[model samples]
Target: MSDSGPTIVLLGAGHAHLGVIDDWLKHGSPPVRTILVEPRDAMQYSGMVPGWMAGEYRDEETRIALAPLVREARIDWRRCRAVGLDPVSREVLLETGERIAFDVCSIAIGGAGRAENLVGRDPRLIDIRPIDGFIERWSEAEDTAPPRRIAVIGGGAGGVELAFGARNSTSQPDVLLIAGEHGLIPGHPAAARRVVERELESQKITVLTGEAQLDDDGALTVGDKAIEPFDAILAAVGSGAPSWPRESGLPVDEDGFIRVGPTQQVEGLPHILAAGDVARRTDVRVRHSGVHAVYAGPVLATNLRRLIAGRSDLATYSPFGKDFYLFNTCRGTSILSYGAFGLKARWLRRLKDWLDRRWIARFSGR
Candidate 1:
């Protein structure tokens, strides 16, 4: 790094930003100094996370140590949550009472779960949202009896994966997937949905679709009738950007996600860029899949370099026209979806396990 005074402050270690950090280190860093400000020392790879829940892998297997990467890149690691930003002053104020000055900045603080929105919730009720927090909850729950009645409130891949993982790992918690929508994985191919539906049925996991709500008694209600009582509720629904971005005065979309150009730079703020789940592209609403985040890394890195070199920051980020989605459903069988195509087999599961191990290995330095 040059002895230049300018600095680039990255707010969170989101998936794409981690790849960007790796690329910038593997190649060469810009003259501007780099600093990563995240609340956690390790970043959990969301892809292998389901395996951890299934008891097939440990928590350590899902996380990558960010300290080494930050050191190798000669970047400072600020352990704190960003509360707000002063664009005119070009400084970020953290919740820990420290202010970081930067010539350029990027935000990737990630999404949050609104468990507080639930009515009459137990303070200890597990909300499997953040990796670190969820790991702790899972550990504690493991020591106790397996949850007698568990409701996973979402129909997305995450919810499905978690439901199967719980069933595989525990004494069958009377698992039920409550999807408010018409079906699980609404926009996914019908073939893929059918496969998942069949798997859920085979596992004896209940599927509640159309209309459902989690009442105070931990009961999932469907159209004025209480279906069942749950010992715990794990929500994978209503995921959105952290409240900080909108509160920080950045230009965010109606859903509170930051809007970015193809170059990954914030729409109005040239010096501030965003990627990962928090970023939304106006032209193409890419499925917030890890693949897109992985693919956006190089582009974000190149544009960051260009911005530092007094050149135009222009890099194209194209969404995958045909996303190849691979997920393991706890019974050691894998599901694959590419565009409208679908496939499932034990061999596919092994392949997915290998792929996840390799991907995590890159970051974990195993």
Candidate 2:
């Protein structure tokens, strides 16, 4: 075996990359030169964000710093963002006007919050993706007089948690949830939806069932009705990919997310891989969440190592059979959902808090 293999670029400090680093830390040093490209030294764990919004967690608790992991694994840390990818040349272009060539690459840059109609029309609206940005904006917003009328768009898990968490906060701004055409928690099981629906009613938050569109004046219309003006608006409609990857000529699904197979390899580019929200599985339908991302991490690490070693055999990513979830609620309670099974209780909130802290602590090295 060669003492050193090819250079592998680890793009974005997302969950999957953490697994790769953790694997290297415990098992062995990186088999090849590794460089991590990210704009921030640390990233917020999406799971605990709802709790943070509800005043259950401090700012520091939600962050997982990259320094300790990188130092332990001996991976080069690039404190900048990747602006472009040239797969044809196997190089990543950084925002700092530098281009680094790589023999293999893995992207975990995460996805942008889908705010196509809501946030684009209203610049003041906050988006839930790029988690750190949302946290910063919301924290600043909370410092001033709380917005009396608040509107949260979307009905997915993130949207539901944000709506309920906002209502639970000390400010307790009146929250209006635009559940969209499919209604509350559309893809979740019947029982889970019912539990969340009951929680919303108990919180006294307004629910609008229909598609949310913006008029010319930045006003919102739900189906056929006009809603009251909101001093604060948040969009958690779901995630969308950045335009650069597609522009770079990488294969992507209709939504612009990089198309990756079971091995986390970009279609037609086996040497380049992607995972997490920024990547969409083409072989199977998989739900996008922090849970799935974490599950795919070890697979990503294994496959990346194989590619770097010039080996054809690689590992594949498979989703867990039953992934459980918890949603933050009022009065230090939470909604626990696992397929058809679901519950709402104060003790469940403690469990969710412990799980979030545990996940963060796993990599925090603090």
Residue lDDT tens for model 1, 232-251:
77776645677877887888
Candidate 1, superposed: residue stretches over 4 Å from native: 1-4, 118-120, 123-125, 216-218
Residue 60 in model 1: shift from native, Å? 1.3
Writing each residue's lDDT as its tens digit, candidate 2 over 1-366 gives: 112447889999898888888888878865578989988988888888887888878889899888888887899888998999999888899999999888889999999867864435675588888799899889888887677778999898989999977887768889999998889887677888888988898889888888887777777778667785888888898888888999999999999999999899999998899999999999988878888888888998888778777789999887757367888884688888887777999999899888888888788753
TM-score of 2: 0.95
TM-score of each: 0.93, 0.95
Best by lDDT: 2
Clashing pairs in 2: none
Per-model CA lDDT versus the true structure: 0.78, 0.85
What is the Cα-based TM-score of model 1?
Answer: 0.93
Worst 10 residues of 2 by lDDT: 1-10
As for candidate 1, its clashing pairs are none
Which candidate has the top score in TM-score?
2
